[model samples]
Structure formats: C-alpha cells, structure tokens
Target: MEESEILRRGLDAFAELGYAATTMRELARRLEVSHNFINDRYGSKEKFWRAVVDFALLDVQSELDHRMAVGRDDGERLRNVIVQLYRLSAKASAMNRLMSDESTRDSSRLDYLHQRFIKPFWDSIEPTISSLIAAGRIPDAPTHIWYFAVTGPALALAQDPIADRLNPAASPMAEQDRNGMADALSSLVLQGLLPLSRGDATDRNG
Candidate 1:
C-alpha cells in the first residue's frame, strides 16, 4: 500500500481502538498488509504516531486556509475560524482520549504532542491572532489567552459525558451562536480585560 494510505489507516485505527490497543499487527491487518510489512514501512509505533501528527497538521492548515478565504467581516471571519476548529476537535477526539486515558502509561508521548503538535498549532495560528491585535479588539489580551479562548470550544467538543456536563455540546452553531460566541469572546478581550492602551481607545470613547 502507499505510505500515506498506510498512515491514514493507522490514524483511524489508533483513534478508534486507542493507541495501545491498536498494534502494528492490527494496523497491518486493517491495511491488508503483513505484520512485517508494517514494521518495515513505519519502523515502530512511535514512528507511526509521528506520521499521524503530520497528517493532522496538514488537515489543520487546509482548514485554516479555507476559513481565511471565506469572509471579510471580523465576525464572519471569526465564526468560520471557530467552525474549522470545532470540526477538527470532533474529528480528533480519539487523540484527546489517548492523552487523557493513557497519560500515565507513556508520559513522553503526551509531551511529544505538546511540543510537536500543540505548540506548532499555536504558532501556525498566530497570524490570524495578530490580526485581532491589530484591529484593537484584543489590545490587552495576551496572545496565549486569546489562543485559549478561541480554541477552547473546539477542544470541548471531544468531551465524554463528564466533560459534557462542564461544557455542553450543541449543534454545529447557527448564525446566532456564531454571533453570540464571537461577541462574547471579543468583549472579554475588549471590555472585560484591561482596556486598550492605545490612544485610539481614548479617541473612540471620548
């Protein structure tokens, strides 16, 4: 099988079956390849996970591009961005499950995710973040906090029954939802947090 196809199958299997439960043998079986073939192709489970990270990042980059292309207004742009992020969270719940479920089993793997996937994801999203800063909507909001507020809902989607209680999952958000979420988050940065330090805020308010 093609290398990408093999990796894709491995991701699906890992997500569905859990990382430990999904062995190279099972992955090979799912991909209709011999166990030895799987080993030869990916070397080890860790290597396969590294490939999944690349696959996931590629998906994220494409989603960000699509959202960026779809709108002009800040609210509209932000809404589309939220939708993209939410979808990614839902699709990758398995990875989150692994993090929570197997954290003790292999702490290093989770650390790898924080280093490779999470940090880089934040870096990649920085430009859009800088856009909000430039617009003065979030002049005082730290970039990392802005990152959390914008992406938190997406992460919430992966919740099991326990987490659902803390943050319920609604439908994929209608226009009103988008507007409400965007307005609330924007206000948290603009009106709730430290007021804009720039002279523009004074002029506008005065």
Candidate 2:
C-alpha cells in the first residue's frame, strides 16, 4: 500500500486508541502488513505517532493558510478562521479526542505537536488577530483567552457525548446541526471579540 494510505490508517488508529494504547503491531495488523514493515517504514512508534498527527493536520493547515490569505479585512479574516476551526472540530471528532488525550499530560509527543502543528497554526492566525486588535474590531485581550473563547465550545461539544442526549437541537453531530452550531459559535466568538459599544464603554468609564 501507499505510504499516504498507511499514514491515514495510522491516524485513525491513533485517534481511536491514543498514543499509549495504540501498538505498532496492531497498527500493522490493521494495515495488513507485518510489524517489521511498519517499523522499517516509520522507524519507531514515536515517529509513527508524529506522522499521524502531521497527516491529520496537513489539510487543516492548508485550509487555514488559504482562507487567511484570501480574506479581505481583519474582521472577515477572523470570521473565516473561526468558522473553519469550528467546522474542523465538528468533523474531526476522533482527531480532537486524540488531541485532548495528549493535552492532559506533558510529553515529548505533546511538545512535538505544539512545535509542528499547533504553533504554526497559531502563528498563521496571530497576524490577523493583531490587526483586529489594532483596528479596535476585537478587544485587547491575551491571546490565550481569545483562543479559549474561540475553541472552547466546539471542543466541549465534540468531546461531550451526553450533550446530544441533553440537547439534540444543539448537537453538532448531524450535518444540519453541525452547520447551525458552527454559525452560532462563530457569531458568539465574533460578538464577544467585537469592540465595546459607545454606551458600554461610557458605562465602564463611569
């Protein structure tokens, strides 16, 4: 099989089993190859894990870069990025689960993900954020807080199984529901980031 196909299957396995639980032998078995073949192709389990993450994030990074480049203004760029992020979170539940698993602890794998995927993605959006702040389109808040505000809801919904049972209308698992949730989330984040109105500013000052 092609290397890309191998990496794709590896991503699915890693996403489902996480880094610690996923064995190279099992992965090879799933791929219909010998364990030695996998090791020979990727060198080690760590390398294979890294490859999985890289493969999963490759399209996301590309899409983000394209949207950010094509956006006409700070507001538009930010909106586009937020919408894209929400869409990805809703669609890639398994990948999100894997990321969540990694985030609960400190490890070389986590660090590698940060350096290879997360940091670069954040760096691509930082310029648009800076522009938005300078233009007073978004509040002058710490980047980390902004990140949480933008991503927190989608991640929560993706990880929470009971969410749909509790509120089927708001669940993003269905295509229609996912689009609606994406719209709502984008609006929520955008409205929160927008500059305070004159009355609100005056009241704050008073």
- In terms of TM-score, which candidate is strongest? 2
| Candidate 1, 1-206: lDDT as tens digits | 77777777777687678777888788778989887875587678877777776665566656766786775554445555655666556556655454445444656667777686666666655666577668776555787677667666555444545544544565333212444444455445334333444664664488
Which residue pairs show backbone clashes in model 1?
none
lDDT tens digits by residue: candidate 2, 74-167: 7667777877887787777667777777877799988997898778888988888888778776778898887677667667645546766777
In model 1, which runs have C-alpha deviations exceeding 4 angstroms?
1-9, 16-34, 73-75, 95-121, 134-136, 160-206
Among these predicted structures, which one has the highest lDDT?
2
The C-alpha lDDT values of all candidates are 0.62, 0.76
Residue 59 lDDT, candidate 2, scale 0-100: 79
